[model samples]
Target: MLKKRMINLLATGFYTGLSPIAPGTVGTIAALIFALVWIQKYTISFAFILIFVCGGTLISQWAEELYGVKDASQIVIDEWAGFFIAVFGLGVDKFLLAFILFRIFDIFKPPPIRNLQKFHGGIGIMLDDILAGLMANILLRVALNFF
Candidate 1:
């Protein structure tokens, strides 16, 4: 059972959902690594963004069922998807800014973000992050332009 659980968590990206230290941090790092590696060759960031969004949705739903829990902390695919949105194509050179923005959006869940979470199944799991990501992107864009 323990081995199986570990496999499940690893498959879900290190049980990042259950991380006490910094779940978002773990998820963001995972997402960044993916972006750097998989998206390195792609000139268009939009393609990467779409892939993350769609893939994250399917993976999140699978993790939800595997974990037999809704919004399980061990499932960080949502975080991965969310982080991508927050940092994708913002032209922010600084990693610190991306980190801050991703965390803020994940935690705050402003407006439609909170509303999106009310959705059922994998879509609900994914949509909330999408909203949060969009909010973070908008905020980050504004901040970058200002500063």
Candidate 2:
């Protein structure tokens, strides 16, 4: 019981995923606040993203079993991981743009990003958002170069 509860907590991004609407966005907002407050260095942010990706995989897989749904909406750890990646190495001033871009990429899942969802289990859950974050990061970098 304790293990399940803990998994639930983490997998749900400390229950931010339990929001009645737009749980993934809520989870991303929680992640953004967390990044703003606690993540000071790019190295630290990268480390957390790695941890979230690896741990998120296991916890998300377990969460799917618990919820009896594949990639359930309540599993928003992926969003947390992705949002962190989207803002990776970006300064505070750029986080809002990163957030917006990440949301767009995540929602639309353009090109290969959408294709990643065909994977099964935890990888399937994590890959799409990971790609979305990477895309957002890349686009943000390009946009910054122009301005």
Candidate 3:
């Protein structure tokens, strides 16, 4: 019971992911708070991001089995990992822009992002969002160059 409780708390982004509507968005917003307050520089952010991605993946696998559903909406540690990747090295000024781009890419699941759903369990859940973050990062880079 304790283990399940811990898993639920961590995997659900402190229960923000339980929202019936736009839960992923809520999780990402929580991630934005983490990025703004905790992420300071590229080196530190990399470490934190890696830890989060790994932790999310591990817990998500457990969560899937526990929930009897693959990529259950309640598993939102993936969102935090994705958002961290989206804002990586981009600094606070770009946070809002990254958030918008990431949300679009995630929700739309364009191309490979959608395809990543083919994987089962944690990898599937995490990869799709990771790809969305990658897309957002690439687009932000391009936009920054042009603008």
Candidate 4:
């Protein structure tokens, strides 16, 4: 029971995923606030993103079993992980841009991003968002160069 609860807590982004509308967006916003407040250095942010990704994978796999749904809506830790990746090493000023771009990529799931969802279990749950974040990060870097 405790183990399930703990997984639930973590997988839900501390319950931000429980939002009735756009749970993924809310969870990403929560992650953004956390990044802005506590993640100051690039190294620390990278480490945290790694942790979120690995931990999110395990937790999401368990969440899928518990919820009896593949990639349950309440499991938003993937979003948290992805959002962290989106803003990886970027300044606070770019956080909003990263968030917007991440959301667009995630929602649209262009090309390979959507294809990742076909994989099963935690990898399937996390890969699409991971690709979206990577896309966002790359775009943000290129956009910054031009502007």
TM-score, every prediction:
0.79, 0.95, 0.94, 0.95
Candidate 4 per-residue lDDT over residues 24-143, each given as its tens digit:
999999998888777654443666778878988999999999999999898999998888889888888899999999999988899989889889999899999999999999999998
Itemize residue pairs with steric clashes in candidate 3.
none
For candidate 1, the TM-score is 0.79
Whose TM-score is higher: candidate 1's or candidate 3's? Answer: 3
lDDT of 1 by residue, 1-147 (tens): 775665465446765556686766677777676666655565327776798678777777776777788877667777777777777675436445766776777788767677877787678888877777777778878887898
Q: Which of candidates 1 and 2 is the stronger one according to lDDT?
A: 2
| lDDT value, residue 82 of candidate 3 | 87
* C-alpha lDDT of residue 11 in model 1: 40
Considering TM-score, which of the candidate structures 2 and 3 is the better prediction for this target?
2
Model 3 residue runs over 4 Å out of place are 40-44
* Candidate 2 residue-wise lDDT, 37-84, digit = tens: 775544435667888799999999999889999899989999988988
What's the TM for model 3?
0.94
Which portions of model 4 miss their true places by more than 4 Å? Answer: 40-43
lDDT of 4: 0.90
